[model samples]
Target: MLDLQNIRSQFPILNQQVNGKPLVYLDNAATSQKPISVLNVWEKYYKEINANVHRGIHTLSQLATAEMELSRQKIQKFINAKHDYEVIFTKGTTEGINLIAYALGNSNWVKKDDEIIISYLEHHSNIVPWQMLCERTGAKLRVIPMDENGILQIDILDEWLSEKTKIVSVNQVSNALGVINPIEEIIKKVRKNSDAYILIDGAQSVVHFEIDVQKMDCDFFVFSGHKIYAPMGTGIFYGKSEILEKLQPFHGGGEMISVCTFDKTTYAGLPFKFEAGTPNVGGNIAMGAAVDFMNSIGISNIQKHEDELLAYGQKKLLEIEGLKIYAEKAKRTGVISFNLEGIGIASDVGMILDKLGIAVRTGHHCTQPIMDYFKIAGTVRASFAVYNTFDEIDVLVEGVKKAQRMLG
Candidate 1:
C-alpha cells in the first residue's frame, strides 16, 4: 500500500479548496491529475530545451531530439516492446487507432470477407476507427458481446474467431465500467485459431497495471499519456517490428521520409515511418518523466491501494437506497459508475455534489453503446487514484446522499 498523505501531498492541486470545501477529485478515469514531479519535468523541458526535433544543427535541437528518442526508448522498456523503433509517438489513443486503421488497413491486409472484432466496452476511439476501416475495406465488423454484469463473454470466443478474422482490437480495461478485460487470453485464442493480429487499447489500463507487450504477445498496444498522469496530446503507439514494416505510412511529410522526389518517395525506418512530421518533443519528454514517477511508487502498490478503496467505497455506495453500481460483480479497477434513486439525471446529482466539492464524471463516458445497452442515459462515475483516501470516500458518500435528498 502507498502512503496516502504523502502521495496526496505530492499533488499541489489536492491541497486547495473548492466551493468552501477541500476538493475531492474522483474523475481520474477521464484524465489523471499530474504530480509535482511530472509537472516539474514538463515545465523544465520547455524552459531549458525548447527546440524543434531532429533537423537542426544547433545544440538545442540536438538535445531535444536526443531527449525525444530517449523517451521512445523509455516507453519501449516500460511496455517491454522488443525495440525502441517500435514505440511511435502520437497525439493520444484516438490518433493511435486512426494511425493503425490507415497504415495497416490500407495495405490490403483487411480485404473483402475479412472481419474485425471489438467489444461493447470500447471507447468510441476504438470503435469508430474500425468502422471506418470496415467501410474502406468492405470488411465486416463483429462485436464480442458481454453479460449484463459487464464481464466479456470470452466463453464464446470460438464463435467469433475464424480464418476470416483479420484484425481484433479491444480495450484492456473498460473506461466506463472499470471492468478489466482478459486481453491476454483473447490474444492467445486468436493466435491459435486464426491469423488475426491483435491491438489492445491501454488508454484506461497501463496506469493501473504493469503490462509487457512481449509477454502478452499482442501485435499492437495503444495508450494515452494523460490517462497515465502525463500531459494531454501525448501518447505511445507500439507495434510489432515486423508488422510495422508491412504498414504503409499513415501520413506523408518531411521527417517520415528517407528520400523524396516529385515522382516517388522512400519512407524512414520502423517508427519514424509512422510518425510523420513534427512530433510532441517536450510532451514526450514529460511522458517519460511520468513513467519514471509511476515506477518510483510502483504500479502494484497503487493498484492494491486502489483495490482496497474500491471495496470500501462500493460497500458504502450500496448502502444508499436504490443506488446501483454498474458491473459490481465483475473484477474491476478503482472506478464506481452508479446512479441514485430519484435522481432524474446523473448530471443533476453530479452538479449538486460538485457544490460540496466532490468532483465526479457524469456522462456516457464516450462509450454510448454500453450506456444504450444498460438502458441508461448516463452515470455518475467516481474513479479513484493513488492520492485518494477513505476519508475522501466518506465525504463523497455524504455529499452524494445530500444530492439525493435535494434531487428527490
Candidate 2:
C-alpha cells in the first residue's frame, strides 16, 4: 500500500488553493505535478553544472554529460531494454513518432502502396505524423475501429494485419478513455500475420503500468516525461537495436556525424546518429530524479493506488443523474471521461468545475477521431495520479453536480 499522506507531501503543488478552495487536481492525463525531488534536480543542475553534454573535457561539462547519459541508463533499465543505445532521448512521444515516420518513409523502407495501421483511439500526435508520412511515400493509412464502449474491435486485427502493412502503431492506453489496450496480444498477432514493425505509444500508460519493451516485443515504444512526474522537454524513444541501425538519421547537425565533410558524411552509430542536435541536458538529468522518485514508492504501489482512484471516482460519478461516463465497461487506468446527457458543451462544464477548484481537461483531447466516433464535440476528463485521494474525488463528484445544476 502507498503512504497517501507522504506521497501528497512530496508534491508541494498539491497543497494549494484554487478559487479560494483546496485544489483538486484531476487533469493528470494532461500532465502530472512534479515532486520536490524532481524540482531539486532542476535547481541543482543549473546551480552547479550548467553545461552542454558530449565532447567536453571541463568538469561541469563532464558532469552534465554523465548525468544526461545516466538518465538514459535509468530509462533503459526501467523499460528493460536490452541495450542502452536502443533508448534514444527525444523531446517526447510526438517527436519520437515524427522521427520514425520521417526516417522510414524517406529511406525507401516503406514504399508506395505499403500500409500503416493505427487505431481510432490514437492522439493526433500519432495520427498526423503517419498521415504526413503516407502523403509523402504513397503508403496508405488504416485505422482499427472502436465501438461505442470505447474499446477496440479486436476481431478485426487479422484483417488489419496485411503483408503490405509496414508499420502498426497503437497506444498501450487511450488518453481519452483511459482504456488499457491489449498491446502485447496485439503485437503477437501483428508479428504472426505481417512483416510489420510495431510502435506502442505509452504516453498515457507508462506511469501507471510496468513496461518491458522486450516482453511487449514491439519494434518501437514512446512516452513523455511530463506525464510521468518529470519536467517538460524530456521523453523516450525505445527501438530495437537492429531496427535502429537499419534507419537513417531524422535530423542532421553537429553531434550526429562521425566525420563531417563537404562531399560525404558518415553518421554516428546507433543513438548519436538519431540524436543530432544538442539535447536538453538539464531536463534529461532531472528526468533521472523523476525515475528515482517513481521507483522509490514502487510502480506497483502507485498502480494499485490509482486503480482504487478510478474505481472510487467511477462509483461516485455514476451516482449523478445524466452523467454518462465513457468506456466504463473497458479495463482502464486512472482516467475518466464523461459528458452530461443533455448538456452538449463540455467546455462550459469544465469552466464551472474550475470555479469550484476542480481541475479537469475539457476538449477533444487531441483525439478528434474519438469525438467524431462518439458523435460528440468533446468530453470533460478527470484523470487521477498517485497524489490524488478519494476525498479529492468527492470534491469532483460534488463539483460535477454543481456544474450540472448551474449549467442546467
Candidate 1 C-alpha lDDT tens digits along 222-266: 999998889999998999999999889899997999999999999
Top-TM-score structure, candidate number? 2
Give one digit per residue, the lDDT tens place, for model 2 in 1-408: 678999999999888899988899999999999999999998999999998889789999999999998989999999999999999999899999999998887677798899999998999999999999989888899898888888888668887787898999999999999999888788888988999999999999999979999988999999999999999988999999998998988999989999899999999998899998889887888888999999999999999999999999999999999999999999999799999878899999999988888999999999999999888999999999989999999999999998899887
Clash totals in order? 0, 0
- Model 1 error, position 36 (Å): 1.4
Q: Which residue pairs in model 2 clash with each other? A: none
Kindly give the stretch of ten consecutive residues in candidate 1 with the minimal lDDT sum. 1-10
